[model samples]
Target: MESSLKIGSAQLGPISLAESRYDVVKRLLALLYKAHSFGVKFIVFPELALTTFFPRYWMTNQVDVDRYFETKMPNEVTQPLFDAAKKLGIGFYLGFAELSEEDNRIRRFNTSILVGPDGKIIGKYRKIHLPGHSEKRDDVPFQHLEKRYFEVGNLGFGTWPVFGTRVGMAICNDRRWPETYRVMALRGARVVVLGFNTPTENINHDEPLHLRMFHHRLVMQAAAYQNGMWIVATAKAGYEDGFHLHGGSCIISPTGEIVSQSTTEDDEVIVYDCNLKLGDYILNSVFNFKKHRRIEHYGPITSQTGVDDLIDVSSKL
Candidate 1:
């Protein structure tokens, strides 16, 4: 018999830019109730779960930009979520744009947090591998201004012991990279939770609309299989702010098999009974990182690049 951990992946649909914080919180509370009814111990929400994907528009006003960012985790608006989680005795992973003020200096980041069953924050991860352009470009079909509004994540990836499993987290674009999962796996993460807001159509590229879903599952599956860990990837799908997001939240086993997945581009939950011990079985046999990895031959990844050679000649105006 598999020693399973009851997990829930909540895939949120469209969140309009004009929606109020109160409305978002209500929806989140509803999902919490649903997860609790389903007997889920841990629920994973999508990236920027509280608001629309705001990076699609460029904003110069500080007040306007700060409206979309959360200054504190359990602030006035989100306190209900914490209260609900505690009431239900359920842990959850939530992602949002974080805004902090320290020493009168403002810092912004795309961040995610792992909250315990008691509503205490257990772990936090800021997105390090930020994608998209920093400046506004009128030529592109849509904007991806994540780099403009938020700073690169300073906190490196790390894992924590939770729910009888070593768990880790990554946000949106971080899931596309191998290092995000590998670093956490190296720390003995048996499960990795990731959230994304990926568009169904890449207006900047010629790839098929369905390919985004494929890549989403492929990366997580490979990472789980290669690192001997389970991967729970959730997404905010459907059209929001004139862009269509791909919807295919899923749970992948350590062997890379997708155990459970969301069926629609709506607010829905998919549950999985994940066996933490399966990671041990794979690590001891197939993917024993300490016994099989060849690190000495991969030094170029850390080698410094020449400043002049790194510049794009076509980028010069």
Candidate 2:
């Protein structure tokens, strides 16, 4: 079952300023066709792939806000995308906003899914770390109201036996957190794939554009090396609704090297043949949890309710 899988990370330019989900799907279909041409078995699309980042603006009406969310996967506009993937016999990861009727009420979440080459749903992940403010920030030029639109994701990080390898899914902000990758790594995930839509400018604070790009690669690279897993990070980049997004979609190795990457901010696919077993050596040696890790001993932080007073380590030394 251990085999080389050709994986692609797509870097997409802005969705139309009008936020057309239909057009987005068309673009995805085009990307799928391109992926097929390259013999890519699996493709990773960016977060909020179905529409422009809608939370960037503030809206009061619930119906108006909910319009951006999909009531069901493979709906009228998106069924063709699923169909194309099936026809091409390629699997993929897609991130989108979800409006689900659960427990007799409508709930919204930032969601993503992993599909098999046969186009069947394999596993799903809801983004747990919802970024930005719930209330509209009028002071800033743009808004990030993810906390207003989405509830906390109920499903914890999960890994699945997929594509003859253990794979996991994460959404935009989730990639920034080390725990997101660590949880899946603990679950025997060989590959942790994620999709993101990150703007070039930080609205909350000032940061150089180049520094933002550096940080994006920095965190994922460290996560891959520390966890001994492959990482595929796809991005919805370039300008969306006047905001410029960073597009550095990449496929990373267990050794924390970027094996493949997107060169353009527009719709681009970068593919690499990933060897799933490459991480075993690191997992069994340096990061072998069962053999060397001692989690029970690190209780000072987990056991405390309030911040612990800083100790003078010099005295102990």
TM-score of each: 0.93, 0.94
- What global local distance difference test value does model 1 have? 0.88
Best by TM-score: 2
* lDDT (tens digit, per residue) of candidate 1 on 98-149: 9988559999999999999999999999999888988889987788989998
Candidate 2 structure quality by residue, lDDT tens digits, 40-69: 899999998988888888999998998888
The C-alpha stretches of model 2 lying farther than 4 A from their native spots are 300-317
- Candidate 2 lands at a TM-score of 0.94
Model 1: ten consecutive residues of lowest lDDT: 304-313
Q: How many backbone clashes does candidate 2 have?
A: 0
Kindly provide the TM-score of model 1 when superposed on the true structure, using C-alpha atoms.
0.93
